[model samples]
Target: MSGQHHVMVVDDEAAARDMVGEYLSLHGFRVTLCDGGPALRRAMATERADLVVLDLDMPGEDGLSVLRDIKRRAPVPVIMLTATAAPTDRIVGLEVGADDYLAKPCELRELLARVRALLRRLAAPAAVPGSAGRTETVRFGTKILDLAAHVLRDDEGRELPLTASEFSLLKAFAENPRRVLSRDRLLDLAGARDPDAFDRAIDVRITRIRRKIEPDPDTPAYIKTVRGAGYMFMPEGETR
Candidate 1:
């Protein structure tokens, strides 16, 4: 299964990039190693990678900028490697469209685990929403989330790009409407729970999702925060 997918490792540090590239290669994945942003850009132009392991603390054209560019250019999943201990870097990376992040000097096994989990998600078949069947699409405001297709469509039927993480969260909410779900419960439902995930990771993801599905993200209607509890999915956008 891993043999079919291509993984790209982009880091300024030669040792780190080579280490990851070799490890992934050993695991039967086709791996590409890029020294920096320019190499990454060139590689992306020539071939599509199933996933990217991007280093956040590079010298020029930094990871955040590169992440933004990647999100704008493609829907490929990205996992950021940040050396900074500050939560701000992780938060900003998440906001800029990193599907996930890991601290620097991370364990090789853990990295491989993350890579496998994300690939599984990408390869997983579209789930049938409920036993009733055929009700695959759910509408929130003007946007529509298609469960079977794993894509979000605007009212005009144009596709809006959603990272695997975002789509998983939205699908979780759609499956359990009108129920207040705690952060842990939400992650469990979405199959995205990470031990290293920050407390506000879910909040950041919710904010991002709101921007796409809410008429007014500042005062979200579809996914409402339940104060101390968690969040509730109001399918009808009910105020009361």
Candidate 2:
């Protein structure tokens, strides 16, 4: 499966790109090396990448900007690598839809582990029991969460892009509607528990989900904040 998937590594430094590309290739994964955002965009234009390993500090079009553009164009998972020690920097990466982040000078083994974990999660199916021919869906606001396809579709049936992490989080909410789930519990249910994940990571992910499934993210009707408790999924939206 790793051999069949393509991973793109985008970094301004030749040594950095070569190192990651070589490591992934050795691990039976197809790899592409890009010098910067423009190179990444060109590669993406010609062919699809299953996932992206992007470096935050680049000469032009920083990783955050590149990540925003990539998310706008596709739902491919991205793991950001930043040398910045600031938690705010990592949080900002998450805000722009990064699936995960790693500090610069990261261990190759850890990077490989993260890549495999994310890919596995993306390929894993929701454990919803249903008849073989039937589609499993859950309603969130005006959108339909397609559990089978790992997508959210609007009223007109157009697909709203969702990352693996986002889909997992939404599935957690759908499976336990109306139940208040604390951030810790939510992370456990979503299989998104990361040692480096901050408390606000869940909040950022919820914000992203709301932007897709809520009628108005500012005044969320589907997932409501329970003051200090966490959030509750109101499948019927706000009660009349």
Candidate 3:
């Protein structure tokens, strides 16, 4: 990782653009501010960026559209900012591959923390030697998950649309193949601070994921429920 990271700040508000850009610049980052999607695309074409700070609400091409384009064009880390604070919106953003998210009216310090966390996660070395450059795709039962691209494809090769929480939960299972991970451990991995608030939330996400990946969601084949424990991914060779 370079000492001076390049970050693109995308927001329609002038004050926000300046504030975020200036704050990041002060922290030793090279910042570029864009008012909308078109300007952002133009800037991206000219320079490679290490990260993107994107606003969810925007005129013309919205932030989500821009986020999709970014995922398609480049695998740069993205930290989404939204004013709504809606769980659905947050889930959608994560599902579509955002590295992190911050609700609007957030403290500058909190935003900075999210930015640092995203970058650190992106820069972290792979768990195994030679795994860094390997494509991160996991297959279970009738579904395939592309971690790098954040796409979930069914057995028939159709993409399954998932919410952010669902995607994150599924990814956690896929990465730890065949391991029984408890709710507390999962909350930590998902970056959620309150485990109780997210207790049934993870269950909901898992059920949603099972609907997409399982041959029979009612009696799930891949993601199995451990009666006394949490959840486990029963890979082909693993016993249920």
Alpha-carbon deviation at 221 in model 2, angstroms: 2.2
What are the runs in model 1 whose C-alpha is more than 4 Å off? 131-135, 189-197
Residue 212, model 3: Cα distance from true site in angstroms: 10
Tens digits of per-residue lDDT for model 1 on 183-214?
88876655434566645788889999999999
Query: Order of candidates by TM-score, top first?
Result: 1, 2, 3
Clashing pairs in 3: 91-164, 95-164
Residue-level lDDT tens digits of model 2 in 1-240: 798899999999899889999999999999999999889999999999999999999976888889999999999999999999787788898888888888889899999998998888788776565535777888999799988888899989999889878888888888778888898888765543456665788889999999988878999999999988888999879552
Of the two candidates 1 and 3, the one with more favorable TM-score, higher being better, is: 1
The residue ranges of model 2 lying beyond 4 angstroms of the native Cα positions read 131-133, 189-197, 238-240
Clashes of each: 0, 0, 2
Error of 1 at 196 (Å): 7.1
Worst 10 residues of 3 by lDDT: 122-131
Stretches of candidate 3 off by over 4 Å are: 128-177, 192-230
Cα-based lDDT at residue 45, candidate 2: 98
Ranking 2 against 3 by lDDT, winner: 2
lDDT of each: 0.86, 0.87, 0.74
For model 1, give the RMSD to the true fold: 1.9
TM-scores for every candidate against the unseen true structure? 0.93, 0.92, 0.69
